[model samples]
Target: MPISGFPEWLPPQRMIEQFVLDKIRSTFELYGFAPLETRAVEPVETLLSKGETSKEIYLLRRLQEESATSDDQLGLHFDLTVPFARFVVENNGKLQFPFRRYQIQKVWRGERPQEGRYREFLQADIDVVNRDTLPFHFDTEMPLVIGDVFRSLPIPQAIIQVNNRKVCEGFYRGLGLPDTAQVLRTVDKLDKIGPDKVAAALVETAGATDAQAAACLKLAEISASDGSFVDRVRALGVTDPLLDEGLSELLQVVETAAEHAPGLVVAELKIARGLDYYTGTVYETQLRGYERFGSVCSGGRYETLASVGNTRFPGVGISIGVSRLLGILFGQNALTVSRSVPTCVVVAVPSEDKRSGCDRIATALRRRGIPTEVAPTAAKFGKQIQFADRRGIPYVWFPGSPDTVKDIRSGEQVEASAADWTPPAADLQPVVSAG
Candidate 1:
């Protein structure tokens, strides 16, 4: 069989993915975020408003041959954000102020897939949508919260660079750039294509003058830092009211987040993300050493992104690309699965009558939260112990023996009551750790 970048691991890899998800989910819930899920598809019109993302969408038709003529259709979701917006708008009345939700699910993109990029992949997203106004502080807090989650895991140190679309747009317009949107598209690729190509595109494509192009290049250059970066942008003399307004709002978010999570937020100006829907704050997270993974997680705040009966639904969020993060970590040997699959303490039965004793001990251990399995058949003590070692099960319970347990690795046997015996937490099962 053949496989693409949609990399799959054995039991070990699957266990690592679960570990990453648990850490992300715990962090979101710690901040009072609830959980939510949306259907895989929405009406085409609902999706079209998402701008460039729609181009990456995978369409589902009644029949592949009749797709052109059929109005009956659906498209696999490319991201969780858009469908979540629709959900908030449809159910806005029932939601309370600052409704926080975390969604972990699969989103599909039919675009050409590559390493760390898949036709189908899982995304774990945490979002905050307001019944009315979503305070800008969350724009700063979102990344810190996400960074905190990533930091909690055994994964490497990851950084989240944040920007506001309003600031980028307003700054471009103030500089006499005609097509700010097109200018942004070029700037967004600065990391991939580099500064020179971006500068040429700004001048040739967006009609930016030599001075404007230089100033634009400066605007696009921001590094990983705290809110101090905001002062650098403010020092520029040539600016307009729109630019000033965007800067002010952007400043508030950084200050607000720093007050809570000290040294967490940065007022990066270069994050001209390609998404047109992001009205205010935008963000991208890169693993410290693995910047080539592109962004392990990225998202932003979109104002009035979803409209239910003309009522604008505003929200802010960030998503953890579970599959990509796992793939990279797996490749680097940063992930470790300590326990074998399923079987923990295999209760050995030396005789046919002893099998019943083994079964009783297994049940007793399982009730105490130790995942225990009985030996497949009656066997010699040494053979039974060998089976446990092969499965990475640390302890073997020989029920007929006066001493019921042996640490297979250490070869230490001890006598204990079945109901009272407990394996060290780490030995209970194979633990998948970035540590």
Candidate 2:
């Protein structure tokens, strides 16, 4: 029986996925970000610290163990950020300050699956953490990096929506709401459930009056591609010191993005990244035409999210929802690779007696950086060609004095040397093409 949410791809699909990952990794490294990975399991308490995600965490237990009691219980990490926090705290002694690292790994979430949501998924994350104070420039840098990743890919354009927790919290306080956390949580669901329902929840669950709920919804509805959102927010008639700080930070982020990567960012007040730790700017990404599918990449600024004793580490980061992106792209047939397998050439044997000769030809081709495989059996020449055709192998080499290879698609056989012959650059490896 097939598991529902755990996706396993076939060869071609997996190849396309690897291709996307390579682009993301190279972009991160190009910007001087080092790579780091943490263990899969974290203490349950550590995972639960970020209250919003506790319900989605998958707990760990051994099947053979009878007793559930233990001093410490571990659970599969639902997201990379928590494990990253634990990693930074545990390795604080040896690491340098203002550490920048990129991690690409699988994270398990026990949430219900939908179009772009999955239980088991891969996330590509990049973060910059400082020992005490993190420079505000890192917040602007996060969207720039993500913009490069999306542009380098063969997918639709990704527009990053930016907001700040301080902005939301400060606004809530201005509305005379004592519990900003609950209001933020309810506002985060504005996209999942419409504004009317969110407004009701704000009044009922977050203890907001009808006027307060209406004000909150109005703030959430404001979004713009430039600094215009700052004025729009000011027009809302809410005032607080924290709100001013958040507005300034958000304006800087949007303006910096406009100068560095135009049309790649926007100030969206509704992007209240449900996680409680986000203190400054928050992010949510939406594809050009697939706005309803939700964020394919998102993260935020967490000041003091990772701390030990009196030492606090402030960081800014973002994550690419790898599996979710691929799922949407694959479902819509938006992308595809040129070939299924990596094999570019298949050597054919005339008869059973010549199998050894075909093997030799394949080996020589492989030495020249060509992907070649020999026919398993000395079947008919046509049958051998069919085998290559079935596997999307482009070329079929026939061993002989001259040693020529045929382009199966064109059926054009030409004399070539194994040492120097090369396929058209596009044919060498599977090229991911956007439809």
Regions of candidate 1 where Cα sits further than 4 Å from its true position: 53-55, 62-70, 256-263, 401-403
Give, for candidate 1, the lowest lDDT window spanning 10 residues.
64-73
Q: Which stretches of candidate 2 lie over 4 Å from their true place?
A: 52-54
Q: Score every model by TM-score.
A: 0.93, 0.97
State in Å the error of residue 208, model 1: 1.8
Give the Å shift of residue 247 in candidate 1. 2.3
lDDT of 1 at 162: 72
Alpha-carbon shift of residue 175 in model 2 (angstroms): 1.9
Alpha carbon lDDT of each predicted model: 0.78, 0.91
lDDT by residue (331-382, candidate 1, tens digit) is 7788888865767788888798777777888888888888888888787778
**Lowest summed lDDT window (length 10), candidate 2:** 65-74
- Compute the lDDT of residue 410 as modeled in candidate 2: 93
Clashing pairs in 2: none
